[model samples]
Target: MTDMRAAFYDSYGDVDVLQVGELPDPRVGPGEALVEVRAAAVNPVDWKVMAGGLDPLMEVRFPAIPGWDVAGVVRAVGPDIPEVEVGDHVLAYGRKDWVQAGTFAELVSVPVRAIAHKPAELSWEEATALPLAGQTAARTLRDRLAVTDGDVVLVHNASGGVGRMGVQLARILGARTVIGTASERHHDRLRELGATPVVYGEGLADRVREIAPGGVDVVADFVGGVYDVSQAVLTEGGRYASIAEHDVPGIEDRIVWVRPDGAQLQWLADLVADDRLEVDVVRVFEELEDAGAALRANREGHGGKVVLRVSED
Candidate 1:
C-alpha cells in the first residue's frame, strides 16, 4: 500500500480525536477517477459527523476520513470512464454515502458523476468552496422553488456560504427584489451583492415586510429557526426552501434536500468561467493536519468557508 497523509477520526469524539497519519492512497474504481487533491473545504457536515450527530442518517465507519468538498487534478481515470483524463483540473462533492473518499487527504477517488471541471479563474481553494453550498443554492432557487425574474426572494443568513451564493443566484435569475437577513456587520456587504439586507433578530418578519411589502415570493432559509418568520412574510402561493430543519406551518412540503448534481455544478463552473459567479474563500489552512482546527473554528461560527490546502504549492 502506498501511504498517503490523511486526517482521520478513529472513534466518534471531539476534535482532539482527529489525527494526521499514513493511510492507503485511494485507487479509482470503474467509473471513478483518482484525484491528487490540491484543496478541500470544510463544511458543517464534517463536524456533525465527527461528533456523531449524523450517525443515523449516514453510517459512520470508524476511522472515517470526513470531508466532502475537494478541488484537484486527476491523477488517473478508472477503466470505462472517458469523460475526463489524467491531469484534468476538477472539483467534486464527496457525498459520504455515494462517494466516501474523503477530501481530508492528499488524494481521493471519486465517482465520475461527482466531479466537474474546475473553473480556470478560481483558485483550488475557491473551487473547493463552491460544490456543496453553491449547488445547494442553485438548486433551491432554480429547480426546487422555481424562482424567476419577478419573484421576491428572501435569503436567510445571506452572508454565509450558501446564503451568499443564493443572493448572487437570485440576482442572476433576474429577481426583482432580493432581501437578505444577516447581522449589521454584513449588511453593507450584502448590499454590495445587490440585496437589501435586513438584520435577523426579534423583528425579522416586520423588517422584511417593511422591505418588501408586496410579500416574499420565495424564502431560502439556511437558518434553522427562521421558518415561522419565513411563513409570516411569504405571500399566497409562495414557497419556502430550507437547508436546515424547520417545522413551520404552511411550509412543511417546501424543504430542500441538498443532493449532488454534476450537471448543475458544471453549469456553475461555466458561470465562474464567464465571470458571472464569484466565490469567496475567507481562509485556507496550510495542511490536512489542520482540518480538525478548521472544523472547530467553523463550528464556532467564524464567517465564510474554511479550506485545507492539501497539496504542496
Candidate 2:
C-alpha cells in the first residue's frame, strides 16, 4: 500500500485532537486527479472543524482531514479527466466537506472542476494561497456585489488574506476608491494596494465617511461587527457582502454564501499570470506534522495565509 502523511482528527475537539501520521494514499476517481501536494493553506474552517464548532451545522465523518486550498503538481490523472495530466502544476480549492482527505496530506484527490492551472509566475507556496481566498474575493466583488467602475468599495480587515484579495480585486473591478479598515500598522500597506486605509475601531463609520464623503457603493465586510456600519454607508441600491456572520439592520436578509466555481478560479489564475493579482502567504510550515501548531497560530489571527508544505518525494 502506498503511504502518505496527513494531519487528521479522529474526534472533534481542540488542536490537540489533530494527529500527524502515515495513512494509505488516496485513490483518484473518474474525473479526478491525484495531486502531489506541495502546499496547503489553513483557513478558519480547518480549526472550526477540528474543534467541533461546525458539528451542529454539518456532520463530519471521523478521521477527517482538514484543509481547503492547495497547490501542487499533478502526479496521476484518473480515467476520463482531460483538463490536466501528470506533471501539470495546479492550484485548487478542495471540496468543502471536511470528512474527506484534505490538502494537509502528501497527496490529495480532487475533482477536476475545483482546480485551475497554476500561474507560471508564482511559486508553489504562492499558488497555494490563491484558491480559497482569491475565489471568495472574486465572487464577492464581481458576482455578488456587481461592483463597477467609479463605484466606491470598502473592505473590512483590509490586511488579512481575504481582505487583501478583496482590496486588490475591488481596484481591478474599477472601483473609484477602495477603502480598507485595518489596524494603524497596516494602513500603509493597504494604501499601497490602491486602497485608502482607515483604522477600524469605535468610530469606523465616521472614518469611512471622511474617506469616501459621498458614501460607499459596495461594502465587503470580512470582519463581523462591521455589518451595520457597512449598511449605513451604502448609497441607495449599494451592495453589501460579508464572509463572516453579522447582524446588520435592513440587510440581514441579503447575506449570501460563496460557492466554489472553477471558471472563476481560472479567471483568477489569469489575473495572477498577468501580474494583476498577488498571493500573500505569511508563513509556511514544512510538513503536515506541524499543522496543529499552524492551526493554533491561525486561530490567534496571524496575518496572511498559513500553509503546510506536504511532500512525499
Best prediction by lDDT: 1
Model 2 lDDT per residue over 250-290, tens place: 66555655566677898988898898988778888887789
Give the TM-scores of the predictions, in the order they appear: 0.96, 0.95
Clashes of 1: 0
RMSD of model 2 against the true structure: 1.8
lDDT of 1 by residue, 1-313 (tens): 6988899988888889899998888877898889899999998878888888887777777668878888999989899988899989999886846324588998898888888998788888888999998988998998988888798999999989889889989999989999999888888888888899998989889999998998999998887887778889999989888878555566557777777677888888888778888787778889877888888877877557889898964
- After superposing candidate 2, which stretches have Cα over 4 Å from the reference? 96-98, 246-253
C-alpha lDDT of residue 188 in model 2: 77
> How many clashes in each structure?
0, 0
Taking all chains together, the TM-score of candidate 2 against the true structure is 0.95
